[model samples]
Target: MKIIKNILFLVVLLSTLQGFSQEILTKKEALEIALENNFGVKIAKNNLEVAKNNKSIYNTGFLPTASISSGANYSNNNQTIDRQDGTSTSIDGAITQSYNASLNVNYTIFDGLGRKYNYQQLKETYNLTELEAKETIENTYLQLFTNYFQIAKLTKNKENLNEALSISKKRLLRAKYQYEYGQSTKLELLNAEVDVNNDSITLINANQLLSNAKRGLNLVLGIEKEVNYTVETNVDFTNILNFDELHQKMITNNTTLKQNEKNIAISEFNIKVNKSNYLPSLGLSTSYGWNKSQNPATSFLAASSSNGLNAGLSLSWSLFDGGSTKTNIANSKIALENQQILLEQQKITIDNTLKNTWENYQSQLFIINAQNKNVITTQNNFDRSKERFKLGQITSIEFRQAQINLINSKTALNNAKFDAKLTELQLLQLSGDILNVEF
Candidate 1:
């Protein structure tokens, strides 16, 4: 019975593997998986949550603090006592007990409006984090899409390899038949066998490449288990032949650019926060307390009780700090200027990037169009060469060349399509619209 159970488990495992090995993945499905499971996305989202929590007003010391405390103590000690009649007595132990309790409240009445500025700084910082998370998502999706399309190309190349191998096999068979009929030399048969072997090896290598590509794609999707899957051979592009619209969108919506703007605002607020140190600060504080004392030696005469409320207003100012505040303000001004420069530099960089990717998209489109006809012609040429080789009208070398041409054309077209997909996604990314990826 144990052996039967083991056999049943083996059968089930095999069935699962067979089914999983035939799974197909789509671009949108892969994107959804990466968005949910990718580590970087998860970390960015956590950072955004932290920033949001930091921007809270109550948490940032905006409100007053109130506390209540109670304490008690008892003491015993030896003491000497003297009376006015010139008689003295030594007490072995004298005991005393006391209790006190207080309720206190403190509030910052004024601090050059520093708390208000701090609150604005935190709000801007939170906005910066939000944009940073968006940038991470956009960049990660580009990488994922690139890997996915790579797998698509590898799949097509594998298909091309298989077709070439099949052709070699048929040609080898034909060569043998011709030699047996005294129509081909022994050298021709030998060459035919060599070509067939070479094609098989090439096909094997192509399969390995395809497997690696699939593994890369799975890693991008955050998948840990090894399973085989096929990707669709479709990458589409729309050529706008214009960068003006993309440029405008990028200026308004680009994540990094917007993040830089937030940084500038934070720096301006920092200047205010630093300058606040020059002004005097005012504080309001109040306390209510109760105290009681009892003496065991003479409880009737030494017992006492006091309860009251006290309040006060305090003010302070920093007269000097070895030029530290001045230095900080100057540094803040410099930092603000630097941030504004970076913001402008980023605009220039993004403009250059957009133009380059636009040109690349157009170039890939041209290559795809050119290769489309080339592949059709090569396929026709290969079919004819196959017939000619079988009929002894062409040599195996000539037929191999035709097969290579067909494979090259097909591979080139696939690569061009994949390149176009990359540029299209890049353009969309620069335009701040990558999350809307389709097809």
Candidate 2:
């Protein structure tokens, strides 16, 4: 009775430990964690902020620049002077002091509206960064989704292996009993033992794979410490997408396309900026200054003080810069052309990818349905074979074959479901609809 009590206590303790170790990590939770901690997403967000700051008029050269400067200095020196009339004079501890302060302002009065174009360019750059950030976020989401579903797949595979192992164990027990009663040969019992060993090894490997997969997911979640978690095994494939609608969304909302459009706009603005060099630029400059100086020993004018305000206008035109301006404008136009070409190429590539992925997703769904029916059929065969083996109507080898078939069918079904979900996710990503998926 005492031993029984100890065994019960140990069982309860292990159950508690297992419960504490397992965490339920849902897809939403994983994505939320990644959004907050992913390095790529963080960098993209920072880039967006920098672009937003640059979009300001002050950074675009439309605002005047103002600055203030001040300085003070003191010096002591021993001096000797020789007069022109043949008289010599010496002075000791001659002290001098000087102070100066100034405030200056400069504004570009005109530059062929270059500042206006530049400001527009900055705004376009900000828009580009926004798209870039969205792209990064969507990519991250897709990665997490893939990893999460992989875990689910492995989890289901492990369960299938476990079930197979359990069946092998039961067969081993029946073989042992039959041999002890002289109803089975020793060779048959040995074969059952071997099969049990194989199943156990397979299950061990499955467990190891599951552990490694979990560790990979933890890394993606940016968790420095390994966390034990179990994900949901059910794959959802509820999003039914229409091809025409998806294509339209891809054109209007695709991050890469939007970014390319912004780039083209910026390149056009850049050409304008370079062309502005052909016209003269006028600038206004104004300054207020104060100066004071004193000297204890001097031949003439021992001290001086000055204070004034000054203003000036400057104009500049580049008549010949070795054709630099022309080259720059040409390059800008070429860059704009490249952007347009890339946009077209991307549209084609994305369209083809979308069609392929959509077809693949549909095929996966059909495969899953077929595998489901196969699992049911194989499971019935295994059950019947188990009964027949017990009645000596089938050999142990035949029963084992039936069991293996069941396991394989289940594995294929599990894989098919997850693969379909992943393909669907790819479709959404291509359409830029992944960003709309709520965590």
Candidate 3:
């Protein structure tokens, strides 16, 4: 019977190993796929490109504008004129023709330096968009790693369930032989049968969980079709995290905080832009024009033509205009103040989050250590209990307890290890180092 049990265990192990014939999807591959295919990352990149395109001299009103225009008109008229000397002259169907053409150029030479400030504002806006894009990519990294590790966890769970089911079947088979030989009661055999049935159901549920987990990973990868693959079960823990260093990095490198800093700069530029409205503006305009007219009914001139170049300078001061400029400047100042306040608030929020995440990571690491020891102990207990049960030295219930302990310990250890990995990832994310994680 013992020889048969050993053979059964080896067969089950070999079958389970064979079931994992799919390709291995590594962490690096998952991240690379997400970089190329994730919807959020692509959208964020497009937005950054838009911001970059907007950072141009034309958009900031820093360039001159030129226009060319031409027109012609022809008309026929019946006319009658009475002179002062009591003489009258009448004409019919007199032809008239006129033509005009012009080229104009206008430039704002100075507007209290508003153009400079506007250009600076555009630059700051582009920077802010860059930070936003970085934030989105980092967030996608977190989500991808989270989903990838979840699949790994569920896969390990299915393996554990398979082993448990195998053990239950072996137990049931031994129970049958003992009862047939009149060494064990029917009650023992029935109990073993019940355990086998329960284990089978648990394994079925585990398989469903694994399938769902794989689908989740596929969604994160932006794969429209579902794919089956195995993952590397080994998770390397990061143990060198320092709260002080991480907090400092969060202040300097965190995308949200950096975006807020850019916002503050943009607000400052806006205030300058509005204040410039109070000063006088200077502009330059130049044009070249040609005009010609022909009238057969004219008394003095039959045809006339003229051409000239014109130039002018304009100076306009907003002495008073219903206080619109003043009001705008005041509003801009208020907005800048609000941005400063928000920056402070964001700092506080990030500080608290970093503290909490660091503590949780430490706790998970400790739990992983404890579970490692527990798994070892439970495995040894299960091995000894199996031998005792074969020698008819322990009851079925006692043996079942040992088996349950082993299974639970393995499950717990797997959960702990993966949970710790996730917590470590959170720490990296909070520190703005998620993209730098090692495979």
Clashing pairs in 2: none
> What is the lDDT ranking, best to worst?
3, 2, 1
Question: Model 2 over residues 1-439: C-alpha lDDT tens digits?
Answer: 3563576467558856975889889888888898898888899999999998999866988789999999999988888888899987787888889999999999999998888888998999898899899999988888888888999999899889878877887687788788989999999989989998999899889888888888888767777645467888877665666888988988888878888889889999999988988899999999999999997765477899999999999999888999888999999999999999998998898889888988898889899889999999999998899889889999988999999999999999999999998888888888888867754
- Encode model 1's per-residue lDDT on 37-71: one tens digit a residue: 88889999999999999998776677999999899
* Whole-model Cα lDDT of every candidate shown, in order: 0.85, 0.87, 0.88
The CA-based lDDT of model 1 is what?
0.85
State, as a TM-score between 0 and 1, how close model 2 is to the true structure. 0.89
TM-score (all chains, Cα) for each model:
0.91, 0.89, 0.93
Top candidate, metric lDDT: 3
Q: Which candidate achieves the best TM-score against the true structure? A: 3
RMSD (CA, angstroms), candidate 1: 5.9
Instruction: Count clashing pairs, candidate 3.
Output: 0
Which lDDT value does model 3 have at 172? 87
